[model samples]
Target chain A: MKQISTRLSMAVHTLCLIAMLPHECTGDFIAGSVNTNPVVIRRIMGMLKKAGLVDVRPGVGGAYLLRSPEEITLLDIYRAVNAAEEEQLFGIHVNSNIKCPVGRNIEGVLQAEFQAAQSAMEQQLSGVALKQLLSQFKE
Target chain B: MKQISTRLSMAVHTLCLIAMLPHECTGDFIAGSVNTNPVVIRRIMGMLKKAGLVDVRPGVGGAYLLRSPEEITLLDIYRAVNAAEEEQLFGIHVNSNIKCPVGRNIEGVLQAEFQAAQSAMEQQLSGVALKQLLSQFKE
Candidate 1:
């Protein structure tokens, strides 16, 4: 069974908390809620910050929301965390000689198809929002 | 950047070759095509055989395609190779107390989301045929 890493999951959760709390959230507080290390929370927050999703201040202050929950989707968080949306979701190591007919050509074709597949996946995730996830949380 | 491993990629490529070839393919033949150790090919073939994607006959005979190429998808190949689709794609390792509320709750929820995401991805790959992959082969 392939599994989703806690990093992306936790990152989304933290972002959601900030989105939910808006003005009152802190990285330490979010980390507590996520039951993870503060540094880990900060690393993810840094990415979200770069993406203009969140604002963070050093010392004595916590992270704050920059974007509305409605504007953010799971895909936003996913991309923010630097998920591999390109490349095959599974690696197939074929280091065959490029001089060989099948070896030289397969990767390009597979990558093209894989990209299309990932695009579809990103589209699905983009439609799901923090608000939608919160609804699931409420239930 | 988190990336998929080469093992699964090689396995899928190998499978695609067998699917496209005119007759039964052996590990030695596949190894030559893939430029890998025959033992490596057989090891992977063992996994594919267990997944019911291929059938193997020992003693003079090699492996043959049991499942139709069209019936299989990149995702099916992925699953057979034990590629971690949802969790850690590039291998992020973090240990949390499973007894914690966030830890316990997150795994189940995240897993479901990952599975959904993976299914969406799979459906896309499933739409493409190995025969299509054959068109891309060039020396």
Candidate 2:
């Protein structure tokens, strides 16, 4: 089974940890929790920071949410990490024969449906906040 | 931009030709319209065959739709071409630390949301029948 990038789930996990245990969330700690390298955590944290979802402390170190968990939607993290593949969730055959009506018009026709489907997924992500997601964690 | 697979679009293109120009839709001819290799068309056509959407002529050669264009939805093509990636549209980090609450629970928590999001996308695709799509083609 092929899924989208694991970066999205990692981003959400990073944020959930930050929200749950703010002071302990250094790159190393988050990495340990995420079961990945600190470099991976740093990279995702870099993306999260660039997206304004989280910010690091000055000398104290470790990262913190820039906004509340309730304010941060999964779509925010999705858009943050997936900036490169923004509107390309569904690929079309690039070089269709121009003389063929179906080939000529498939991309244009499929583009609308692809965009709509992608948006429907994104809309579902938007509806789920980090707060709601974190609430599911065991005590 | 990483799109799912051109196979979905190609599958649609393959079926459209079969529906619109049934007598002329040999694999080579369809490949010409799709602007790809006949091998690629054959592979996709094979998947469509396994999915019961189309059938190749016995001795005559070329393909025809087993079902009417109205009976086949984009979702059907999406599933057919993407059989290997069924229900994995959104990926979660695989190796989260079990000792950590966020790590242990993130996959479970995110699975529901991912499923919902994936379902929403599938639902949209299901709504778009191939008949509806071909109607948008130019005369």
Candidate 3:
């Protein structure tokens, strides 16, 4: 309900589709499969392309694979999409001033813990490769 | 910088302070410590109290420990304050109609993966008890 980023999910979904059928995907085709706008697919694909996960040709040309499915982890896609990390999944605590001792140190402590949690999340994603996701593509 | 939810940070900071001292805490006091409004502290405390993490007294009263520091985890605090799962961190993919096959299934697939990742995150947070966080509390 909260904290899980949609961009991360979009990235994984797109990558999995590509990994399932490499060298034959296009932004428009993938967009149709995802029921989203071609422009949106292209945006995500742009990120994937930048991450070296996909190789794309404009206009008549299509998108292809540049990396092995096994080498592409969910974490890879997450980072590729540049998923926003600073935002909390839900609400925030009311802001505090830096002048106070508790407020001064609060950011550092919370950030450290959040970083640890994030690391755990990344590790979990890393455990699932694009190949793994491809295996689930029963379509 | 953009999405750093002050809520989680504030909750952790507030709880850590309460856990540090062997005394009752008030929202006003906690707010003062965090340099924020007491109303915000009260809101957070309200949720914490509901979660059985803290005991709050209304009308000229303060908050006290309902659960031991060692008994609590960051995940517990997160759940208490968030009132929802962490997987929906950045919100779900919008603009895609659920009537479409891909759109309908997209939420399910993304939800599953997000839950898996969230479970892993909770596991990590559960491993780190509030006692540990309190111990790390710097003066």
TM-score top scorer: 2
lDDT of 1 by residue, A29-84 (tens): 76777776778888888888888888888775667767677888878877777755
Better of 1 and 3 by lDDT: 3
Task: Please give me the DockQ of candidate 1 compared with the native complex.
Answer: 0.43
- Residue-level lDDT of model 1, residues B67-113, one tens digit each, is 67677777677667773344333222344345444443555665566
Better of 1 and 2 by DockQ: 2
What is candidate 1's TM-score for chain B alone? 0.71
Model 3, B69-101: lDDT tens per residue? 889988888778776644355456755545444
| Cα RMSD (angstroms) for every candidate in the order listed | 3.9, 1.5, 3.8
Model 3 chain B: worst 10 consecutive residues (lDDT sum): B95-104
TM-score of chain B of each: 0.71, 0.94, 0.79
**Which candidate number has the best DockQ?**
2
Q: lDDT per prediction?
A: 0.69, 0.87, 0.70
TM per candidate comes to 0.81, 0.95, 0.82
Q: What would the per-residue lDDT of candidate 2 be over residues A31-130, giving only the tens digit for each residue?
A: 9989889999888889999999999775686888999988999899988988694567887888899888888898898889899999888898899999
Report lDDT (Cα) of residue B27, candidate 3: 76
- Fraction of the true interface contacts (Cα pairs closer than 8 Å across chains) found in each model: 0.47, 0.89, 0.46
Question: What are the DockQ scores of the candidates, in order?
Answer: 0.43, 0.78, 0.42
For residue A95, model 2's alpha carbon misses the true position, in angstroms, by: 2.2
Candidates by TM-score, descending order: 2, 3, 1
Query: What local lDDT does model 1 show for residue A11?
Result: 79
